[model samples]
Target: MLGLCMGLAGVVWAELPAPSFTLAWTHTIEKIRWEEDYRVTPSGLLLGEARIKGSGAGMEIPDGAELREGAWHYQSHLPPLQPLRLGRTPEAGDYQLCIDQRCRPLGDWVGPPQADRPALELWSCETGSGAG
Candidate 1:
């Protein structure tokens, strides 16, 4: 009986799920043409990597170029979010951001569709809030 109880407890503990992250906020943009700009730090470095994906005109994405090969996939490691700007001023939004332990967007999912792909939008979020 003692062994069975311990085994059951171990199983339950192992089955427990990990905590989730949430998005802080999101920003909608009209377009992202020209050189993709990102935030930079004082030492001139990227804050995080900016991964861009979607289908559009004249967007050539070679096969096996990335984990997902849709109509387009352009990714770059961006500098920290301190000295970043979008054109004349900064363009961004804040939404809660979170991540599932098992799910990876670009790594796990297929690329965007071919036709009727809308203009790209940048989404920013914090961790844990049930937002995507």
Candidate 2:
């Protein structure tokens, strides 16, 4: 009976789901943009593969770029990363992006939120273009 109960418990544990959240960021410099998305769990970790995409002529991932970041802590905490933690996720409605301390509302994205696909286009910024 003990062995049987243990086996059943294992089955139940296997079905438990981990709390999760999705995060996407876009860092635009000059005319180029860098973006990344991660599926994070309660433990503040990437659940699976992360999605990455960018648009530019000659740009590389910055030195501090990371899939798991401190912002996740703020994002998971009771208070979301809103006015305090700008450039992250929004509180409600439409996605957004921040650049040089300025933020703008974004429309629906074009493709899937995947590495190759990516989520919506979110927002855009230009270095002195004044066209954003």
Candidate 3:
């Protein structure tokens, strides 16, 4: 009985499935794009990576670029609050192929994951709300 009780407790504390989703944003004038693949644990910890793509002027991803409160801010080495030209590069795999401190967009899941993909909830700072 005690063992069963402990097992139940453990199950109660089991981590929640990470929320899997893809995030994206872009700016045409800057010719830059940004997309991030992330998984958020039930504890609210988000783990993911991103890729940046460019067309005309080349993609520029600043050092301080980060996703804070659901907004990608290319703050360093780029303008503030501007889109980072989000895109995907299947060739780069799990890394950003940067040349001259810049690289074409790398692996960033777009559209949807798979047919069996989990539902996605998009959080937008601009809207200050989440949408499915």
Candidate 4:
């Protein structure tokens, strides 16, 4: 089965079951919620959709975005990413990783960030190593 690999400083720390997942976080300045859906592909990770509850500075809706259910939703036109990097500082707060309608703090999968490793790297995992 496909999975996700979470790493710190070039070392794999943990793995989680993931064919697809939604990453949700709050905007530090606007305090509004933002979510992005990503799918794991053999080539890389593909960003499928994005949505934001309300909007403010640096949160302008995209050209083709539709406002639905009190949120602006849109599809990303960008290509797949080989790996995604996320900040894990107190300032950035915690990110909620959702899969199959359940959610959990990202730190639960990879553990809290240390002073030396304040960022987490995520990528598609095809090999069986560490897959849950």
Q: Who wins the TM-score comparison?
A: 4
The segments of candidate 2 whose C-alpha lies over 4 angstroms from its true place after superposition are: 1-26, 45-132
Q: In candidate 1, residue 55 scores what lDDT? A: 28
Tens-digit lDDT track of model 2 for 1-132: 000000011121111121222333444333322332322222223323233343245544444445454222111223221111122223223333322334444332221123432222211112132221
lDDT of residue 104 for candidate 2: 41
Model 4 lDDT on a 0 to 1 scale: 0.82
Poorest lDDT segment (10 consecutive residues) of candidate 2: 1-10
| Winner of 1 and 4 under lDDT | 4
| True-vs-predicted CA distance for residue 25, candidate 2, Å | 4.7
Please give the lDDT score at residue 28 for candidate 3.
46
Q: What does the lDDT read for residue 110 in candidate 3?
A: 26
Candidate 1 wrong stretches, greater than 4 Å = 1-42, 45-48, 57-64, 69-82, 87-132
- lDDT digits (tens) for residues 79-120 of candidate 3: 221111222232222223232343432223223223332222
Clashes of 4: 0
Residues 50-107, candidate 1: write the lDDT tens digits.
Answer: 2335424554444444534332334554433322222111233222222442322221
RMSD of 1: 16.5
How would you encode candidate 4's per-residue C-alpha lDDT over 1-132 as one tens digit per residue?
A: 677777855577877767999999999889999999999887667999899998799988889999999999999988887678888876677889999978898888776656666888888875465542
Clashes of each: 36, 6, 7, 0
lDDT of each: 0.27, 0.27, 0.33, 0.82
